[model samples]
Target: MKILFATSEAHPLIKTGGLADVSGSLPSALAHYKHKVRLVLPAYRAVMERLPEKSLKQVAKLSVGGCGREFEAVIWQLKAGAVPGVDVPVWLVDIPALFDRPGNPYLAEDGADWWDNGERFGVFSKVVAELAMDRAGLQWQPDVVHVNDWQTGLVSALLSVETQRPKTVFTVHNMAYPGNFPHSLFAQLQLPESLWNLDGVEFWGHFSMLKAGLICSDWVTTVSPTYAKEICYPEYAYGFEGVLQKRAAEGRLIGILNGIDEHIWNPEVDELIHSRYSAEKGRVAGKQRNKAFLIEELALLNGLSETRIQGHLADWLQAPLIGFVGRLVEQKGIDLVLEVLPELIEQTPANFVFVGSGHKSFENALRDLAQRYPERMWVYIGYSETLAHQVEAGADMFLMPSRFEPCGLNQMYSLAYGTPPIVHHTGGLADTVVNATDENMLAGTATGFVFYDPSRFALKSTLLHALGLFAKKRSWQKLQKTGMQQAFGWKASAQRYLALYVED
Candidate 1:
């Protein structure tokens, strides 16, 4: 099958969140299965810097939204060697006016999202839709146009306008971030007024790219099975429950758990960390070395004494190194984690390492907590790919107490690296992490801990439970082996996606 993946971000080039990871990994996974896959992403400044000079090929100029604004798009062919036998062609939509700039792709200097995000992504979607219709002129055509999140949601909307359209698959990585714009901006999108209706792009009197994709796409899928069910409820729906429920009633909505790229996550082969270890040979010693290295690094960075560092590691090692790697925002349950920290520290000798940046209030709170308990806590206020891998591999336990996780990759990575995850039983977390129970004799099959409620008490109690189990070396080792053995590969996911594309 010839597949075209339209996304706002892709990894190893430009990334902001999990969407980029998916966009980068999934196509490569599909290509490995011998499917002809092509990816389209905006050529941001970062992408330009990273791309090889020769890989870029000049593609035709694209005119979007009837705005008479032409942008020159370059096609960068990602060969088998580029992604290791994942022969996928990656086309970058280069338009300096919209995508070319400094800093993060989504945020401005003041940390506010670019106000023109709606228009920016809308233009990219229109270009993709246009490209799909022109087979003879283009390098490759698509049987399936897979659009990710709200950024490329408008592609499905645009496809609906054409009679000869390819099968469309819309994957909702997260529904919280709908591409909504004022009703007046409809004219700027150059969409027909007929599309701005209850059954079309209209969402609460606003033009919603997400709504349009949900309504018009051939199939709708979320990241995980539990998330698929959760989105149909009022609390988790983010105002789209009715639409999702309606789609499910029509048998068009489904869920497929996401998989991480194991090639990039293998601890034994990864060069980014201080030490390397495999689950079979070096699990214990490698983890100890990693713990020591982390402690030394943190102490050096923060100018703490050797005694302070030793105390921190002792606390960290007594139970297990429970780690959190993500944005420090309310959605991630940072506030809940903070509220439960003191109780957790008192109940268990677990050390905490947080690596991420978001929300000024949350960042300050984490910083203050790190200062107060420097011996038991470490915080890094930035995103680092290498550091994230170290956290996944080195930590005995990974924490993702998110209020909602559309399709978390870190949890999967943790499983791969023999680090059991303790996550809130919601969305993708519930779908992926099997809650340990006596009935299941979960010792050898358990991957991580899970809590039901999104509260401080629930989180703290769950951590305590995990710490108790960690005290038992045999049980903990069994849990680690079970997690490492679990398969969350993309082959099954890709097959499910192929089925969705073929569905009527």
Candidate 2:
């Protein structure tokens, strides 16, 4: 089958989150199965700069119409994987006026959303629709067009009106940001007037791109089985509960769990960490060396006072090293981590390292708390890809206390790296991480620590439990090896998607 994967961002060229990771990995997985797949995304300035002059080949030049004007764009193709055997063909929609920006694809320099995002993505979607309809002069058409998130939502709606069009699949990564605009902007974009009613893109006097995707597409999917069910209720749906409920009733809604890119995340051949080790060999000593190097590399103990600094390096290496990597925000439950860290630090010998950036309040609070317990805590305010890999490989335990997650990749990364994760029981976290209850532990099926309640007390209690277990060498290694042996690769996921595409 020929498939067109349309997304707003992809890894290596550009990335802001897990969407890029999926966009880059899934297409390669599909191509490995001998299916022709072309991944499409907008050509932001950063993306253009990331590509080599030799790699990009201009495929077509066309005039795209949107927001009351004719915008010129060029379609260019490039191969998108650094690994030897995995190469994905990528198409870039290059429109200077709309996509030639420096920092974020959707944000301005002052941290506000770009004012013309409605027109920008609408024009991009127009180009995508043309390509899917075989009108872009490429002489190649896909049997299926898979669109993701609100950025490419309009493609499904645009293709719905055509008498001869490919099947459309719209996957929602998150339900919080629903690309909504004023009703007046709909006329400005010159969209078909027939689509302005309740059954189409209309949502309570606004033009909603997300609604169009959900209502117009033939099939709808989300990241995980649990999130698929969560979005049908008022708490997680954000306002589209009725639409998803209907889609579910008609058997058009699916919940496919996401898989990680094993090529990039595996510990055996990864070049970023201090020592490379597999779950089968040198797992213990290799982790010890990496943890010691990471602690020294980040100066995790430099903040300690004279008396605290006197501990031997071997002692610090023996203590548990906990890791947190992701945005510091309320949704990630960073506030809960902050609330309980003081008590944890005062009562235990465990050390902590936080890596990532987000809301100002959360950043400031993390900084202040690190200052109070310089010996026990270390913090990095921004993201570093190398540091992320090191944390996954070096830390004895990883923390991902999200209040809700569509599908999380870091916990999977942690599992693959032999680091058991401590997570809240929600969304993909519930689907992926089996709790370390006595029954599961006896069965040798426990992979991580899971807390049921969404509060600081639960997190603290869970952390203490994990710390206690860490002292039991036999039990802890059982959990680590069990997690490492699980399969979280994309081959099975791609097959499931192929089934969706060819099914009657």
What are the lDDT scores of the predictions, listed in order?
Answer: 0.81, 0.89
Off by over 4 Å in 1: 66-87, 306-319
Clashes of 2: 0
Best by lDDT: 2
Residue-wise lDDT of candidate 1 within 1-504, one digit each (tens)?
889899988777678999888887888888877888888888888878866777666666655553445555544444445534234777777777888887677887778898778778887887888778773267666888999888888889888888877889899999888888887777766787778889899989898988988988989998999889988998888798889999999999999998877778877887877788887888878877887776677655666887766765654555467789999998899999999897776766778889999998999998998888777778888999878987887778888999889878888888888888989988888877876666444434567888989988888888888888888898888788777878787888978887677777
Q: What CA RMSD would candidate 2 show?
A: 1.9
Lowest-scoring 10 consecutive residues by lDDT in candidate 2?
A: 300-309
Backbone clashes under 3 angstroms, per model: 1, 0
Q: For model 2, what is the alpha-carbon lDDT of residue 482?
A: 98
Compared to the true structure, candidate 2 yields what TM-score? 0.97
Error of 1 at 488 (Å): 1.1
TM-score for every candidate vs. truth? 0.94, 0.97
lDDT of 2 by residue, 358-455 (tens): 99999999889888876667888888889999999989999999999998899999999999999999888999999898999999999999999989
